[model samples]
Target: MINYLHREQILPAPIEKVWAYFCDPKNLNEITPPDMKFEIVSGGDVKMYEGQVVEYRVEFVRGLRSLWLTEIAHVRENEYFVDEQRVGPYRFWYHEHSFESVPAGVKMTDHVTYAAPFGLIGDVVNAVWIRQRLNGIFDFRYQKIVELFGSVK
Candidate 1:
Protein backbone atom coordinates (compact mmCIF):
# COMPACT_ATOMS: atom_id res chain seq x y z
CA MET A 1 0.00 0.00 0.00
CA ILE A 2 1.09 3.54 -0.75
CA ASN A 3 0.30 6.04 1.94
CA TYR A 4 0.87 9.77 1.52
CA LEU A 5 0.28 12.86 3.57
CA HIS A 6 -0.14 16.42 2.26
CA ARG A 7 -0.80 19.56 4.24
CA GLU A 8 -1.19 23.22 3.38
CA GLN A 9 -2.25 26.48 4.97
CA ILE A 10 -4.56 28.87 3.22
CA LEU A 11 -4.13 32.31 4.71
CA PRO A 12 -7.07 34.28 6.04
CA ALA A 13 -9.55 31.78 4.77
CA PRO A 14 -12.28 29.94 6.61
CA ILE A 15 -12.74 26.19 6.44
CA GLU A 16 -15.80 26.71 4.28
CA LYS A 17 -13.85 28.66 1.71
CA VAL A 18 -11.17 26.00 1.49
CA TRP A 19 -13.75 23.30 1.26
CA ALA A 20 -15.45 25.12 -1.59
CA TYR A 21 -12.29 25.08 -3.60
CA PHE A 22 -11.94 21.35 -3.08
CA CYS A 23 -15.52 20.39 -3.83
CA ASP A 24 -15.75 22.32 -7.05
CA PRO A 25 -14.81 19.75 -9.65
CA LYS A 26 -14.05 22.38 -12.28
CA ASN A 27 -11.37 23.86 -10.09
CA LEU A 28 -9.48 20.58 -10.10
CA ASN A 29 -7.76 21.34 -13.37
CA GLU A 30 -6.78 24.70 -12.00
CA ILE A 31 -4.91 23.10 -9.10
CA THR A 32 -3.48 20.14 -10.99
CA PRO A 33 -0.23 20.39 -12.87
CA PRO A 34 -0.62 21.73 -16.39
CA ASP A 35 1.70 19.06 -17.70
CA MET A 36 -0.61 16.33 -16.62
CA LYS A 37 -3.48 17.74 -18.72
CA PHE A 38 -6.15 16.68 -16.30
CA GLU A 39 -9.81 16.99 -17.27
CA ILE A 40 -13.10 15.88 -15.84
CA VAL A 41 -14.95 13.79 -18.34
CA SER A 42 -18.17 13.56 -16.36
CA GLY A 43 -19.78 14.44 -13.04
CA GLY A 44 -19.26 18.18 -13.28
CA ASP A 45 -21.59 19.06 -10.44
CA VAL A 46 -19.74 21.30 -8.03
CA LYS A 47 -21.81 20.35 -5.03
CA MET A 48 -20.53 17.03 -3.76
CA TYR A 49 -23.47 15.61 -1.89
CA GLU A 50 -22.94 12.18 -0.43
CA GLY A 51 -22.65 9.29 -2.94
CA GLN A 52 -21.58 11.47 -5.85
CA VAL A 53 -19.34 9.92 -8.44
CA VAL A 54 -16.67 11.85 -10.32
CA GLU A 55 -15.15 10.65 -13.53
CA TYR A 56 -12.03 12.12 -15.06
CA ARG A 57 -9.76 11.67 -18.03
CA VAL A 58 -6.10 12.49 -17.65
CA GLU A 59 -3.23 12.42 -20.04
CA PHE A 60 -0.23 10.82 -18.43
CA VAL A 61 3.20 12.08 -19.46
CA ARG A 62 1.91 13.01 -22.94
CA GLY A 63 1.42 9.40 -23.92
CA LEU A 64 -1.22 7.47 -22.00
CA ARG A 65 -4.71 8.65 -21.26
CA SER A 66 -6.70 6.99 -18.54
CA LEU A 67 -10.16 7.18 -17.04
CA TRP A 68 -10.41 7.65 -13.29
CA LEU A 69 -13.59 7.44 -11.27
CA THR A 70 -14.20 8.03 -7.59
CA GLU A 71 -17.17 8.06 -5.30
CA ILE A 72 -17.79 10.48 -2.48
CA ALA A 73 -17.80 8.02 0.36
CA HIS A 74 -18.29 10.53 3.12
CA VAL A 75 -18.62 14.26 3.69
CA ARG A 76 -18.93 16.51 6.72
CA GLU A 77 -19.47 19.91 5.17
CA ASN A 78 -16.40 22.09 5.78
CA GLU A 79 -14.76 19.73 8.22
CA TYR A 80 -13.77 16.76 6.10
CA PHE A 81 -14.53 14.60 3.08
CA VAL A 82 -13.48 11.21 1.78
CA ASP A 83 -13.41 9.84 -1.76
CA GLU A 84 -12.82 6.22 -2.67
CA GLN A 85 -11.90 5.04 -6.09
CA ARG A 86 -14.60 3.06 -7.87
CA VAL A 87 -12.41 2.58 -10.93
CA GLY A 88 -9.16 4.13 -11.91
CA PRO A 89 -5.44 3.75 -12.53
CA TYR A 90 -4.87 2.19 -9.17
CA ARG A 91 -6.19 -1.07 -7.90
CA PHE A 92 -7.14 0.68 -4.71
CA TRP A 93 -7.40 4.35 -3.76
CA TYR A 94 -8.80 6.02 -0.70
CA HIS A 95 -8.28 9.72 -0.20
CA GLU A 96 -9.44 11.65 2.81
CA HIS A 97 -9.37 15.42 2.88
CA SER A 98 -9.71 17.51 6.00
CA PHE A 99 -10.05 21.20 6.73
CA GLU A 100 -9.65 23.00 10.03
CA SER A 101 -10.03 26.63 10.97
CA VAL A 102 -6.72 27.79 12.41
CA PRO A 103 -5.71 31.02 14.06
CA ALA A 104 -4.08 32.34 10.92
CA GLY A 105 -6.24 30.72 8.30
CA VAL A 106 -7.46 27.29 7.22
CA LYS A 107 -5.36 24.17 7.54
CA MET A 108 -5.95 21.57 4.84
CA THR A 109 -4.76 18.01 4.93
CA ASP A 110 -4.87 15.15 2.44
CA HIS A 111 -4.24 11.55 3.32
CA VAL A 112 -4.13 9.08 0.46
CA THR A 113 -3.80 5.33 0.66
CA TYR A 114 -3.50 3.48 -2.59
CA ALA A 115 -2.17 0.37 -4.22
CA ALA A 116 -0.97 0.16 -7.80
CA PRO A 117 -2.53 -2.26 -10.24
CA PHE A 118 0.44 -4.42 -11.07
CA GLY A 119 1.35 -5.61 -7.61
CA LEU A 120 5.09 -5.95 -6.98
CA ILE A 121 6.13 -4.48 -10.31
CA GLY A 122 3.92 -1.46 -9.73
CA ASP A 123 5.36 -1.01 -6.27
CA VAL A 124 8.85 -0.99 -7.70
CA VAL A 125 7.82 1.59 -10.29
CA ASN A 126 6.18 3.71 -7.64
CA ALA A 127 9.38 3.73 -5.60
CA VAL A 128 11.46 4.76 -8.56
CA TRP A 129 9.48 7.68 -10.09
CA ILE A 130 5.70 7.48 -9.61
CA ARG A 131 6.08 8.75 -6.08
CA GLN A 132 8.07 11.70 -7.28
CA ARG A 133 5.50 12.39 -9.93
CA LEU A 134 2.81 12.34 -7.31
CA ASN A 135 4.81 14.79 -5.23
CA GLY A 136 5.16 17.05 -8.22
CA ILE A 137 1.42 17.02 -8.76
CA PHE A 138 0.82 18.06 -5.17
CA ASP A 139 3.49 20.73 -5.40
CA PHE A 140 1.75 22.18 -8.39
CA ARG A 141 -1.52 22.09 -6.49
CA TYR A 142 0.04 23.87 -3.52
CA GLN A 143 1.38 26.60 -5.73
CA LYS A 144 -1.98 27.00 -7.41
CA ILE A 145 -3.75 27.26 -4.07
CA VAL A 146 -1.31 29.91 -2.96
CA GLU A 147 -1.95 31.77 -6.16
CA LEU A 148 -5.71 31.53 -5.83
CA PHE A 149 -6.01 32.19 -2.09
CA GLY A 150 -2.80 34.12 -1.31
CA SER A 151 -0.55 33.49 1.72
CA VAL A 152 -2.29 32.61 4.98
CA LYS A 153 0.09 34.52 7.24
Candidate 2:
Protein backbone atom coordinates (compact mmCIF):
# COMPACT_ATOMS: atom_id res chain seq x y z
CA MET A 1 0.00 0.00 0.00
CA ILE A 2 1.07 3.59 -0.55
CA ASN A 3 0.92 6.08 2.29
CA TYR A 4 0.78 9.88 2.35
CA LEU A 5 0.80 12.24 5.29
CA HIS A 6 -0.13 15.92 5.49
CA ARG A 7 -0.25 18.26 8.45
CA GLU A 8 -1.29 21.88 8.77
CA GLN A 9 -1.98 24.45 11.45
CA ILE A 10 -4.65 27.13 11.25
CA LEU A 11 -4.10 29.88 13.77
CA PRO A 12 -6.69 31.59 15.98
CA ALA A 13 -9.40 29.12 15.05
CA PRO A 14 -11.03 26.46 17.14
CA ILE A 15 -11.13 22.86 16.06
CA GLU A 16 -14.87 23.05 15.42
CA LYS A 17 -14.45 25.87 12.96
CA VAL A 18 -11.88 24.00 10.95
CA TRP A 19 -13.81 20.76 11.15
CA ALA A 20 -16.97 22.43 9.94
CA TYR A 21 -15.22 23.84 6.93
CA PHE A 22 -13.60 20.58 6.00
CA CYS A 23 -16.68 18.40 6.48
CA ASP A 24 -18.85 20.53 4.28
CA PRO A 25 -19.19 18.69 0.96
CA LYS A 26 -19.56 21.91 -1.02
CA ASN A 27 -16.08 22.98 0.03
CA LEU A 28 -14.52 19.93 -1.61
CA ASN A 29 -14.38 21.60 -4.98
CA GLU A 30 -13.12 24.78 -3.44
CA ILE A 31 -10.03 23.08 -2.11
CA THR A 32 -9.38 20.95 -5.17
CA PRO A 33 -7.20 22.29 -7.92
CA PRO A 34 -9.04 23.76 -10.84
CA ASP A 35 -7.08 21.54 -13.17
CA MET A 36 -8.66 18.48 -11.62
CA LYS A 37 -12.20 19.77 -11.95
CA PHE A 38 -13.32 17.87 -8.89
CA GLU A 39 -17.03 17.90 -8.21
CA ILE A 40 -19.32 16.01 -5.89
CA VAL A 41 -22.01 14.11 -7.78
CA SER A 42 -23.92 12.83 -4.76
CA GLY A 43 -24.08 12.94 -0.99
CA GLY A 44 -23.60 16.65 -0.62
CA ASP A 45 -24.77 16.77 2.95
CA VAL A 46 -22.78 19.26 4.97
CA LYS A 47 -22.85 17.20 8.15
CA MET A 48 -20.89 13.98 8.15
CA TYR A 49 -22.68 11.37 10.20
CA GLU A 50 -21.38 7.86 10.36
CA GLY A 51 -22.02 5.75 7.25
CA GLN A 52 -22.32 8.77 4.99
CA VAL A 53 -21.20 8.07 1.46
CA VAL A 54 -20.01 10.76 -0.92
CA GLU A 55 -19.60 10.27 -4.65
CA TYR A 56 -17.39 12.51 -6.73
CA ARG A 57 -16.27 12.86 -10.30
CA VAL A 58 -12.90 14.28 -11.24
CA GLU A 59 -11.55 15.30 -14.59
CA PHE A 60 -7.84 14.72 -14.65
CA VAL A 61 -5.48 16.36 -17.08
CA ARG A 62 -6.67 16.16 -20.68
CA GLY A 63 -10.25 15.36 -19.70
CA LEU A 64 -9.64 11.94 -18.18
CA ARG A 65 -12.61 11.49 -15.90
CA SER A 66 -12.92 9.13 -12.94
CA LEU A 67 -15.54 8.46 -10.32
CA TRP A 68 -14.77 8.16 -6.63
CA LEU A 69 -17.09 6.96 -3.91
CA THR A 70 -16.13 7.16 -0.26
CA GLU A 71 -17.91 6.31 2.95
CA ILE A 72 -17.43 7.90 6.31
CA ALA A 73 -16.44 5.08 8.64
CA HIS A 74 -15.95 6.86 11.90
CA VAL A 75 -16.46 10.35 13.24
CA ARG A 76 -15.82 12.33 16.39
CA GLU A 77 -17.19 15.80 16.36
CA ASN A 78 -14.51 18.47 16.20
CA GLU A 79 -11.88 15.79 16.63
CA TYR A 80 -11.42 13.35 13.80
CA PHE A 81 -13.03 11.55 10.86
CA VAL A 82 -12.15 8.49 8.84
CA ASP A 83 -13.26 7.83 5.28
CA GLU A 84 -12.75 4.60 3.41
CA GLN A 85 -13.12 4.15 -0.28
CA ARG A 86 -16.12 2.18 -1.43
CA VAL A 87 -15.26 2.74 -5.06
CA GLY A 88 -12.78 5.12 -6.54
CA PRO A 89 -9.77 5.75 -8.79
CA TYR A 90 -7.50 3.60 -6.70
CA ARG A 91 -7.71 0.00 -5.69
CA PHE A 92 -7.72 0.97 -2.06
CA TRP A 93 -8.07 4.34 -0.35
CA TYR A 94 -8.47 5.16 3.31
CA HIS A 95 -8.07 8.61 4.76
CA GLU A 96 -7.97 9.61 8.39
CA HIS A 97 -8.42 13.28 9.24
CA SER A 98 -7.68 14.40 12.77
CA PHE A 99 -7.87 17.75 14.50
CA GLU A 100 -6.17 18.68 17.73
CA SER A 101 -6.73 21.78 19.78
CA VAL A 102 -3.54 23.73 20.19
CA PRO A 103 -2.54 26.81 22.07
CA ALA A 104 -2.19 28.78 18.88
CA GLY A 105 -5.00 27.16 16.95
CA VAL A 106 -5.94 23.76 15.55
CA LYS A 107 -3.44 21.27 14.27
CA MET A 108 -4.89 19.16 11.46
CA THR A 109 -3.42 15.90 10.28
CA ASP A 110 -4.29 13.88 7.19
CA HIS A 111 -3.17 10.32 6.75
CA VAL A 112 -3.95 8.55 3.50
CA THR A 113 -3.26 4.92 2.72
CA TYR A 114 -3.96 3.79 -0.80
CA ALA A 115 -2.99 1.27 -3.45
CA ALA A 116 -3.33 1.29 -7.20
CA PRO A 117 -5.24 -1.25 -9.30
CA PHE A 118 -2.34 -2.98 -10.95
CA GLY A 119 0.19 -4.68 -8.71
CA LEU A 120 3.91 -4.07 -9.28
CA ILE A 121 3.45 -1.58 -12.08
CA GLY A 122 1.14 0.44 -9.92
CA ASP A 123 3.64 0.43 -7.11
CA VAL A 124 6.31 1.80 -9.40
CA VAL A 125 4.02 4.51 -10.71
CA ASN A 126 3.00 5.44 -7.19
CA ALA A 127 6.61 5.69 -6.11
CA VAL A 128 7.34 7.99 -9.00
CA TRP A 129 4.39 10.34 -9.66
CA ILE A 130 1.21 9.28 -7.91
CA ARG A 131 2.66 10.09 -4.53
CA GLN A 132 3.74 13.49 -5.70
CA ARG A 133 0.34 14.15 -7.17
CA LEU A 134 -1.29 13.28 -3.87
CA ASN A 135 1.03 15.68 -2.13
CA GLY A 136 0.11 18.37 -4.60
CA ILE A 137 -3.55 17.88 -3.73
CA PHE A 138 -2.75 18.49 -0.08
CA ASP A 139 -0.67 21.53 -0.93
CA PHE A 140 -3.63 23.00 -2.78
CA ARG A 141 -5.83 22.19 0.19
CA TYR A 142 -3.48 23.93 2.57
CA GLN A 143 -3.57 27.07 0.52
CA LYS A 144 -7.35 26.89 0.30
CA ILE A 145 -7.64 26.61 4.06
CA VAL A 146 -5.49 29.63 4.49
CA GLU A 147 -7.56 31.53 1.97
CA LEU A 148 -10.79 30.58 3.71
CA PHE A 149 -9.57 31.20 7.23
CA GLY A 150 -7.12 34.01 6.48
CA SER A 151 -3.48 33.92 7.63
CA VAL A 152 -3.15 32.16 10.94
CA LYS A 153 -0.22 34.16 12.22
Candidate 3:
Protein backbone atom coordinates (compact mmCIF):
# COMPACT_ATOMS: atom_id res chain seq x y z
CA MET A 1 0.00 0.00 0.00
CA ILE A 2 1.18 3.52 -0.72
CA ASN A 3 1.54 6.01 2.14
CA TYR A 4 2.00 9.75 1.96
CA LEU A 5 3.66 12.56 3.90
CA HIS A 6 3.51 16.32 3.34
CA ARG A 7 5.39 19.21 4.90
CA GLU A 8 5.62 22.94 4.17
CA GLN A 9 7.74 25.68 5.60
CA ILE A 10 8.59 29.26 4.72
CA LEU A 11 12.26 30.13 4.79
CA PRO A 12 13.36 33.73 5.22
CA ALA A 13 15.55 33.59 2.17
CA PRO A 14 15.37 34.35 -1.51
CA ILE A 15 14.12 31.70 -3.91
CA GLU A 16 17.47 31.55 -5.67
CA LYS A 17 19.35 30.99 -2.43
CA VAL A 18 16.92 28.29 -1.27
CA TRP A 19 17.04 26.69 -4.71
CA ALA A 20 20.82 26.43 -4.61
CA TYR A 21 20.73 24.89 -1.15
CA PHE A 22 18.24 22.18 -2.13
CA CYS A 23 19.81 21.40 -5.49
CA ASP A 24 23.30 20.79 -4.19
CA PRO A 25 23.39 17.20 -2.95
CA LYS A 26 26.44 17.97 -0.83
CA ASN A 27 24.32 19.93 1.63
CA LEU A 28 22.19 16.86 2.33
CA ASN A 29 24.30 15.70 5.24
CA GLU A 30 23.91 18.99 7.02
CA ILE A 31 20.10 18.81 6.97
CA THR A 32 19.76 15.10 7.71
CA PRO A 33 19.51 13.80 11.24
CA PRO A 34 22.87 12.95 12.80
CA ASP A 35 21.56 9.64 14.12
CA MET A 36 20.84 8.33 10.65
CA LYS A 37 24.47 8.86 9.64
CA PHE A 38 23.36 9.75 6.14
CA GLU A 39 26.24 10.17 3.71
CA ILE A 40 26.38 10.69 0.00
CA VAL A 41 28.59 8.00 -1.49
CA SER A 42 29.05 9.90 -4.76
CA GLY A 43 31.85 12.42 -4.60
CA GLY A 44 32.38 16.02 -5.79
CA ASP A 45 29.87 18.83 -6.29
CA VAL A 46 26.73 16.96 -7.21
CA LYS A 47 24.25 19.02 -9.21
CA MET A 48 20.59 18.17 -9.46
CA TYR A 49 19.33 17.45 -12.96
CA GLU A 50 16.51 15.55 -14.61
CA GLY A 51 18.54 12.40 -15.15
CA GLN A 52 20.98 12.54 -12.26
CA VAL A 53 21.19 9.63 -9.85
CA VAL A 54 22.33 9.89 -6.25
CA GLU A 55 23.72 7.13 -4.06
CA TYR A 56 23.88 7.19 -0.32
CA ARG A 57 24.68 5.05 2.69
CA VAL A 58 22.20 5.40 5.50
CA GLU A 59 21.90 3.73 8.88
CA PHE A 60 18.36 2.76 9.66
CA VAL A 61 16.79 0.98 12.64
CA ARG A 62 18.99 -1.13 14.93
CA GLY A 63 22.14 0.19 13.25
CA LEU A 64 21.45 -1.62 9.99
CA ARG A 65 23.16 0.16 7.14
CA SER A 66 21.60 0.22 3.68
CA LEU A 67 22.56 1.60 0.33
CA TRP A 68 19.94 3.79 -1.32
CA LEU A 69 19.89 5.09 -4.86
CA THR A 70 17.46 7.63 -6.18
CA GLU A 71 16.97 9.28 -9.54
CA ILE A 72 15.97 12.83 -10.17
CA ALA A 73 12.96 12.22 -12.35
CA HIS A 74 11.94 15.80 -13.00
CA VAL A 75 13.19 19.34 -12.53
CA ARG A 76 11.71 22.82 -13.02
CA GLU A 77 14.56 24.96 -11.82
CA ASN A 78 13.60 26.91 -8.71
CA GLU A 79 9.98 25.83 -8.95
CA TYR A 80 9.97 22.11 -8.14
CA PHE A 81 11.66 18.73 -8.63
CA VAL A 82 10.82 15.07 -8.18
CA ASP A 83 13.05 12.23 -7.06
CA GLU A 84 12.11 8.58 -7.28
CA GLN A 85 13.78 5.67 -5.60
CA ARG A 86 15.64 3.36 -7.96
CA VAL A 87 17.00 1.26 -5.11
CA GLY A 88 15.98 1.60 -1.51
CA PRO A 89 14.09 -0.07 1.35
CA TYR A 90 10.76 1.04 -0.08
CA ARG A 91 8.84 -0.85 -2.67
CA PHE A 92 8.33 2.53 -4.31
CA TRP A 93 9.21 6.08 -3.33
CA TYR A 94 8.39 9.35 -5.06
CA HIS A 95 9.27 12.63 -3.45
CA GLU A 96 8.53 16.13 -4.75
CA HIS A 97 10.31 19.18 -3.51
CA SER A 98 8.49 22.41 -4.33
CA PHE A 99 9.34 26.05 -3.88
CA GLU A 100 7.31 29.24 -4.24
CA SER A 101 8.07 32.88 -3.80
CA VAL A 102 5.87 34.31 -1.11
CA PRO A 103 5.52 37.74 0.45
CA ALA A 104 7.50 36.75 3.51
CA GLY A 105 10.08 34.57 1.81
CA VAL A 106 10.22 31.29 -0.02
CA LYS A 107 7.67 28.59 0.69
CA MET A 108 9.23 25.15 0.46
CA THR A 109 7.20 21.99 0.54
CA ASP A 110 7.87 18.27 0.50
CA HIS A 111 5.41 15.75 -0.81
CA VAL A 112 6.32 12.09 -0.37
CA THR A 113 4.49 9.04 -1.62
CA TYR A 114 6.01 5.69 -0.76
CA ALA A 115 5.09 2.07 -0.50
CA ALA A 116 6.68 -0.45 1.80
CA PRO A 117 7.67 -3.94 0.68
CA PHE A 118 6.27 -7.29 1.96
CA GLY A 119 2.57 -6.56 1.49
CA LEU A 120 0.84 -7.32 4.82
CA ILE A 121 4.11 -7.48 6.64
CA GLY A 122 5.07 -4.16 5.14
CA ASP A 123 1.77 -2.66 6.22
CA VAL A 124 2.41 -3.84 9.76
CA VAL A 125 5.98 -2.62 9.62
CA ASN A 126 4.93 0.77 8.28
CA ALA A 127 2.30 1.07 10.96
CA VAL A 128 4.66 -0.05 13.70
CA TRP A 129 7.99 1.39 12.55
CA ILE A 130 8.40 2.83 9.05
CA ARG A 131 5.77 5.54 9.35
CA GLN A 132 7.10 6.89 12.61
CA ARG A 133 10.65 6.61 11.45
CA LEU A 134 9.82 8.59 8.32
CA ASN A 135 8.10 11.26 10.36
CA GLY A 136 11.02 11.43 12.77
CA ILE A 137 13.41 11.89 9.90
CA PHE A 138 11.32 14.75 8.54
CA ASP A 139 11.09 16.29 11.99
CA PHE A 140 14.84 16.29 12.23
CA ARG A 141 15.11 17.70 8.75
CA TYR A 142 12.68 20.46 9.66
CA GLN A 143 14.62 21.39 12.76
CA LYS A 144 17.84 21.39 10.83
CA ILE A 145 16.32 23.61 8.14
CA VAL A 146 15.12 26.06 10.73
CA GLU A 147 18.56 26.11 12.28
CA LEU A 148 20.19 26.86 8.96
CA PHE A 149 17.57 29.26 7.62
CA GLY A 150 16.33 30.81 10.84
CA SER A 151 12.86 30.56 12.41
CA VAL A 152 9.86 30.93 10.10
CA LYS A 153 8.25 34.29 10.70
Sort all candidates by TM-score, best to worst: 3, 1, 2
Q: Give, for candidate 3, the lowest lDDT window spanning 10 residues.
A: 38-47
Q: Compared with the true structure, what per-residue lDDT tens digits does model 1 show for residues 1-153?
A: 664656655556776777887888788888888777788888866688789899998876578888989899999998888999998888888888888888888878888887777989988888887778888888888888888888854
lDDT value, residue 52 of candidate 2 = 93
Whole-model lDDT values for every prediction = 0.81, 0.83, 0.91
User: Which scores better on TM-score, 2 or 3?
Assistant: 3
Give the Cα error of residue 35 in candidate 3, in Å. Answer: 1.3
Candidate 1 backbone collisions, by pair: 11-152
Off by over 4 Å in 2: none
Best-fitting candidate, scored by lDDT: 3
The superposed Cα distance between candidate 1 and the true structure at residue 73, in angstroms, equals: 0.7
